[model samples]
Target: MLQESHTAVIARGQHWRGEVATEPYEAAWAKEAIFFLRALKVEGSLQGTRANIQISADGIHWADEGSSLAVPTTAGEVTFCRISHFGGFLRLVVALPEGARIQVVASLNLKA
Candidate 1:
């Protein structure tokens, strides 16, 4: 049988400051998933910045799934993280340096 797959663009040309979480996605059918985060531009240092893949049951609350992406300091760089055994809803949460802003595009890829 062929596997099912899908990609969702959660954040598009959006500017992130301090900390932010991408919109939730429902993918209970998916057995595997990956998140791609692209930094288009940065207003300050990317030091100490991190992005984590979070899972949720009702889409309103979230918990870290231990899957994380190491955010690059350089602009135009892309980072990714893989996750599995996630319950249903998923999202990406990023914590950036204080007073720094990053314009980014976040994509969630899933397969079953």
Candidate 2:
């Protein structure tokens, strides 16, 4: 995790180089929030990968807020920016194929 004043940059989870069904990261923010998503270059065998942004009024129940984004499986990078108008909970959901090694970073800015 990294922080600059009110902004926070974090790795959703450990190096997702193993086989996992779904990796979800959650955080809380003000009513109006800014988010940045970036997928680092992945290594090793690659396959179908997907990611999406989700939000919720409560942490337990979440709803997809943005269109499903395809995650680059090869050695490349992808990024996305979003400004949320509702809900106080935000998360990034990523699906990695078996034998896929990936690293994703997320940054959150909370208005003062």
Work out the TM-score per prediction.
Answer: 0.93, 0.61
**Can you write out model 1's per-residue Cα lDDT over 50-97, one digit (the tens) per residue?**
898889999998888988897767788998888889989999888788
lDDT of 2: 0.58
Across 77-99, the per-residue lDDT of candidate 2 in tens digits comes to 55555555645666667756666
Q: lDDT of each model, Cα atoms only?
A: 0.88, 0.58
Least accurate stretch of 10 residues (summed lDDT) in model 1?
66-75
Model 2 residue 19 CA deviation (Å) reads 8.2
| Model 1 CA deviation exceeding 4 Å by range | none
Model 1's TM-score against the true structure: 0.93
